[model samples]
Target: MTLALRLGKTLAELAGHQAPMTARELIFWMAFDQLSPISDRRSDVHAAQIATAVYQSQGAKVAFDDVLIDWSGEEEGVAEDDDALETLFAALSQS
Candidate 1:
């Protein structure tokens, strides 16, 4: 599946219902939270590998550098909203 489709499925699974947000939006939030300020090269590389698999599943081109650049840029204004994050986490925890 595409990254978007995979993320959407994950979001649906986590939420226990249809996600209210789009896959791109959810990925933006996750990239903002998870990809930015990545302190460990090992983990970063692992994430890139997973991203590549997802992209390839949908026959999409893998461009880790470009994706990382975009994700880094997205992190600028994407502050961690505790309330929203908490809600999402709560849903995930229940699943």
Candidate 2:
């Protein structure tokens, strides 16, 4: 499979676990996986750039921060960071 396919799959799996992740968390995940160190501050700009490239490759029109999303899909205003996800998950789990 292509890199885009791999990334999409990974993203889907991640999204499946919970709501959308923040750019910072996504960056961290990418860097942690050794894809690229888009996790740092200076690296953030580059990370966004790379994510945009990946997004385009996947034919996804939305950028990283457009909404709350998981592997299944997206919801408006959902963040992509652990804190935000945790809060959302907590609320969701209670329901």
Candidate 3:
């Protein structure tokens, strides 16, 4: 099975329900896995970059701050790393 499918199944099992997972959630999980050592500032930035691309591609408006919150369980409205957000947008624009 594809990575997404596998992830969906895993997420379903974790949730104890077979509810469908959205592309955004799958992409977020994939990126999070690839960008481990999340406590490291650099890895967090990279994961946010990838997740931003995935969400934007789907026409979703997700902020880096929100991504950080979701990934790290950080409080909402916490300040985001501006440099990381800029880098993410720059990379996405180039693609």
TM-score attained by model 1: 0.35
- Clashing residue pairs, candidate 2? 15-70, 15-71, 16-71, 20-69, 21-80, 22-80, 22-81, 68-78
Model 2 RMSD in Å is 17.7
Q: What lDDT does candidate 3 reach at residue 70?
A: 52
Q: Each candidate: what lDDT?
A: 0.64, 0.59, 0.69
Winner by lDDT: 3
* Candidates sorted on TM-score, descending: 1, 3, 2
Q: 39 in model 3: Cα distance from truth in Å?
A: 6.9
Candidate 2 local lDDT, 1-95, one digit each (tens) = 13434475445355566545568756656665564432244355556677788887989896765422233445567556898888999999999
Q: How much is 36 displaced in model 3, in angstroms?
A: 18
Model 2, 35: alpha-carbon shift in Å? 27
TM-score of model 2 relative to the true fold?
0.27
Better of 2 and 3 by lDDT: 3
Least well predicted 10-residue stretch by lDDT in candidate 3? 1-10
Give one digit per residue, the lDDT tens place, for model 3 in 14-70: 667767776877777768756553336766678888888899899999887657535
Candidate 2 regions exceeding 4 Å error are 1-40, 64-95
